[model samples]
Target: MRVGDIDISYDDQGDGLPVVLVHGHPFDRSMWAPQVARLAPRHRVITADLRGFGETTVVPGKTPLGVFADDLFGLLDRLGVERAVWCGLSMGGQIVMEAHRARPERVRGLILADTFPEAETPAGRAARHAAAERVLREGMGPYADEVLDKMISPTNVRALPDVAAHVLRMMRGTSPEGAAAAWRGRAERPDYLDSLSRATVPALVVVGEEDKFTPVDVARRMHATIPGSTLAVIPGAAHLPNLERPAEFTDAVERFLATVA
Candidate 1:
């Protein structure tokens, strides 16, 4: 669906109540392919390429994260979906939080995967900006392999080279400007811990056991703050557990949705 100067591409499949799955940075709707395939059979699944990622075009100077959330709301409006259960990964998690803040009435539940409430710390923000700068200056190819190496578990890196290559290719496909804008906008996002604590929506937080980027500690903190939120750590996976352990990740999501429903 094309919405407000942007072509928002999305996949809507299956039946039952709507469940939206949003992907992280440098990835698009394809990142949720495995999840969609698994969950679409049991639930209505909606996945989209957040603007400037995948087949979506980049709007230079735009705050990608904010626009990304707006795009989701716009898509939901177009689909006649009044409310939905949102499951987002990494940058997608940030977008979901913003969306929930914007339209709490439309969010039935929240699932924040492999992300945090705030990245306001000097060191953390600087590291994010530096990574963005590196991507812009060096281009994505040179660092693509290294990034995938770190994001995926060592076993997956060794055994699933093709999968790793696909993720690297997606990273290379992202525009430098878009990536940088998203990084900067997300880095400056306000702390949502307080909001999470007071939220009425049922929330779940999931992360990989070996996730270095967001880490288990961050997930724990988020879980501790969000009242009654459940946190699950996927073993033998890193940042992109959805890709590395699709079945396990899907099962966890199913369990969470069932409990919340």
Candidate 2:
């Protein structure tokens, strides 16, 4: 669906209370396929391609994460989702924070998976930006492979070839300009620790045991900041535990939801 000037593409399925699934940077709605399959049986699952990632192509000049949040709200409005339990991963987590900041009443609960509330430090941001630029300059093939290798556990990469292939395909499908824009947007997100502290809704902070991208320590700190949020770490997984260890990831989510519900 076209929301404002952006072409917002989403998959809506199953029944019950709404659960919005948001994906990380350089990937699209397809990245949440496993979660959708697991959650849709008991929840109204909505997975969207954030602006500029999947079918949702954005205008070249846009650079704000708030705009992406607006796109999410617009999608909810178009779909008649008044209040939803939000599950966001990485960039998706950033968007969820923006949504809570923008319209707290629309959110029932929060699930932040492998994401942080603030940008990396100046030096770290520079290093990440440089790496991203190198990826763009060199083309996505090598970078996509490297990204998959970093995102999932080695066991999943070698044993679950299909999962690894799908992730690489999703990463490779991203446009270089879009990927750069996403990285830039993420690097500029506001310090949202205060926002997390202020949120009263039930929340969950989840991470993969081997999530070097957003380590378990970061997830623990986030859990500490959020008054009542629960923290869960999926064993033998990396950045995307939901993909590498679907059963464990889904179980944690389900348990969290039971508490929140």
Candidate 3:
């Protein structure tokens, strides 16, 4: 669908309560295949490739969290969806938070997984800037190869070869220009803790027990800050628990959806 200057690629399926799934940075809508398959049977599951990722237009420059959020709201408007549950992971989770902050009434609930609400630290921002430069210089292959194990647990990389391969393929195939642009934009992200704390809608925070990036403690703190929010820690998974431990992740989402309904 055309939203402003870009064409967003998305799949809208099923026929119940609307649930939009946003993919993380450097990945595409395909990352949500597991969740989409499970949730679409009972709800309207809409998965979209963010600008510069997946099949979407590669803008080659800074695309702020607000831009991503606006693109999503535009998509929802096109679909004629008044309000719906918003579920996202990593960068995608941050986009969901931004969306809720901009238009709280349009967000029915939030499902944040493997994500944090804090603004980027100075050191973190520097690291992101360096990564952006590195990817732009060396392309995505080198970085994808280096971070394969970090994206998922080392044990899972060994045990779930196909999943690991899929993860690697996604990262490697990502446009370096697009990835760099996202990194640049993400470094400027604002803290969303205040927004999450003020939210009156239901929230579900899911994180991988072995997530090195966000860690369990971060998720715990986020869960505690949001009144009446639930936290489910998936064991034996790393950053992408939804793919590494599909059943456990889906089960948590299923229970959360029941409550939302």
- Per TM-score, the best of the predicted structures is 3
Worst 10 residues of 3 by lDDT: 56-65
lDDT of 1 by residue, 85-174 (tens): 999998899888888877789899999999878747988789878877887898777767677877787788888887787788788888
Off by over 4 Å in 1: 62-64
Tens digits of lDDT, candidate 2, 1-261:
988887888999999879999898878898888778888888899998887788887554335678888888898999999999999988788889888888889999999999888756887668657755876688667778777778887778998899898888888888777777777666667877888899999999999999888899999999999988899988899988888888999999989877766
Root-mean-square deviation of each candidate, in angstroms? 1.5, 1.6, 0.6
**Best to worst by lDDT, what's the order?**
3, 2, 1
**Model 3: per-residue lDDT, tens digit, 1-261?**
999889999999998999999999789999999999999989999999999998999998788899999999999999999999999999999999999999999999999999979999999889989999999999999999988888899999999999999999899989999999899999998999998899999999999999999999999999998889999999999999999999999999999999998
**What lDDT does the true structure give each of the candidates?**
0.84, 0.85, 0.94
| Cα TM-score of candidate 2 | 0.94
Better by lDDT, candidate 3 or 2: 3
Could you estimate the TM-score for every candidate? 0.94, 0.94, 0.99
Task: Kindly indicate the candidate among 1 and 3 with the higher lDDT.
Answer: 3
